[model samples]
Target: MNNPHQNARMTPLGRAEMVRRIVEEQRPVAEAAAGFGISRRTARKWLARWRAEGAVGP
Candidate 1:
C-alpha cells in the first residue's frame, strides 16, 4: 500500500504545530483543529500527547 498518511492533510510536525498553536499561541482547540483541517477530537489527542509527554510522535 501507499505510505500511510501519504494523502493525509497533516503530518507529525503538523500535529506538533497544532499543539503549539494551542499551548503557545493560545488558540482554541477547535480553532487549531479547524486551522489544521482536522477534527477537534484529533487535535485534542495531539494536545493530550503534548500534555502527557511534552512532545509529539510515539
Candidate 2:
C-alpha cells in the first residue's frame, strides 16, 4: 500500500512539536515557522486551529 505520509514534509508529531514550540516555549510564530520549514501563514493557521479546536480538530 502507498503510504500517504512517506513524501510528506510534516507529520503528526511534527505538527505537535511545532505547536508546542510556539505555545509552550513561547517561540515567535515566524521563527517557529521557519524552523519547521513552513511559512508563517501556515504556522498561524495551525496555531489558530490549536487555539480553536486543539489536537483533535476536525
What is each predicted model's overall lDDT from 0 to 1?
Answer: 0.77, 0.79
The TM-scores, one per candidate, come to 0.78, 0.79
Q: Which ten residues in a row have the lowest lDDT in candidate 2?
A: 1-10
Model 1, which residues run further than 4 Å from truth? 1-7
lDDT of 1 by residue, 2-55 (tens): 233667777767777888888999999999899888899878877887788776
Per-residue lDDT tens digits of candidate 2, residues 10-34?
A: 7767877899998999999999999
Give the distance in Å from residue 24's predicted Cα in candidate 1 to where it truly belongs: 0.5
Which residue runs of candidate 2 sit more than 4 Å off their true CA positions? 1-7
